[model samples]
Target: MLFDTHTHLDAPQFDEDRDETIARALEAGVSRMINIGFNRETIPTTMKLAETYDFIYAAVGWHPVDAITMEEGDLEWIASLCSHEKVVAIGEIGLDYHWDTSPKEVQHRVLRSQIGLARELHMPIVIHNRDAHEDIVKILKEEKAHEVGGVMHSFSGSWETAKLCLDMGFHISFGGPITFKNAKQPKEVLAKVPLDRLLIETDSPYLTPHPFRGKRNESAYVKLVAETAAEIRGMSFDELVQITTKNALERFGIS
Candidate 1:
């Protein structure tokens, strides 16, 4: 069995054939997936995916890019959603410097608030950090995020940065970028991250792996991430799948 610790299966890109994509994933050995919601708007779809697909779980939160426009009741309402049995965590939340979607200060404040809410809810988080590694690590440290461990979804950082997140109890999740020729940084991180802290994902319809790169990705392709992680760790594909699946379940409170 395999687990896709992070994936935006709720994204509009899957609107045409979401069910087909999910069936493909199941056939490809992805036994479990966490449908990541990036903002207030994405939460309903995320929850619906979880309700519709027994194997699909839900993670809801405001992304760094969309944190600015979220209304007052959004966080409170999203927090309330955590009470649902299918909801596993609070996330897809963090800092993103790759795009200037909002002022840095606003993103930082929103992230801080979400961090606190996740802690209060006692749920793991699914983090997304881009060019803002320093700030991401700083806020995680400042917020005492270790108390609520989560996965560093689509992790792309140096061993030093990976170490910081690992030290603070975050799992290092590798995605399609790890299979890219120019992705030296994530590759380096893949080689160094301990087996237990390792997780894999496709980040579907976004970072499709090598064999399917540039095409719309789905959870079925998660094995590609597992295959790549196996090569990085000098282990077999089955072993990688087992360890990562265990890690994903532990963090998300899944069976």
Candidate 2:
């Protein structure tokens, strides 16, 4: 069995065949997946997906790219969603400096608020760091995010950043990027991360893996990520799947 620790199966990219896409994932050995809702628009669709599929789960939070859009009571909206049994985590929340759509200050505040909410709820968080490594780690540290650890979704940082996150009790997750031919840093980071702290994902409808690169990603393609991860760690494919699946279950408190 496999667990796609993070994904965006709710994206409009898959609206035409969402159910079929999920079926393909199951057929590819994906037993569980966490669909992220990073904004006001996606959250409801994500919850609908989680409620529909027994194997699928939900993570609700704000995305850094749209941090400027968050209004008063948005944090409370996310908090209230956490009470849902299928709402397994508070995340896909972090700093994203590359987009430049949201001001850094706004992004930081929104991230801090979400992290604070997660800590208050005693729930794990799923982070989305992009071009703001130092600030991400710094904020996480200041917020004492270690008290309720979470996954660094689709981690693209160096060993040093990974180490800091690990020290803060976070699990480092990899996605389709790891399967690329020239993804040197991610490969090295994956090889060095402890098996217990390792997880995999698709971030689907995006980050499509090798052989399928340049195409839209899907949860079904997570098998390609698992295969690559196994090769990188010098372990059997089955073993990698087992270990990562267990880690995901524990990290997200799925059971």
Single out the weakest 10-residue window by summed lDDT for candidate 1. 34-43
Compute each candidate's TM-score over C-alphas. 0.98, 0.99
Candidate 2: C-alpha lDDT: 0.94
CA lDDT of each prediction against the hidden true structure: 0.90, 0.94
Best by lDDT: 2
lDDT of 2 by residue, 19-89 (tens): 89999999999999999999999999999999999999999999999899999999999999999999999
TM-score of 2: 0.99
RMSD in Å for all candidates: 0.9, 0.6
Clashes of each: 0, 0
Query: In angstroms, how far off is 220's CA in candidate 2?
Result: 0.5
Candidate 1 wrongly placed segments (more than 4 Å) = none
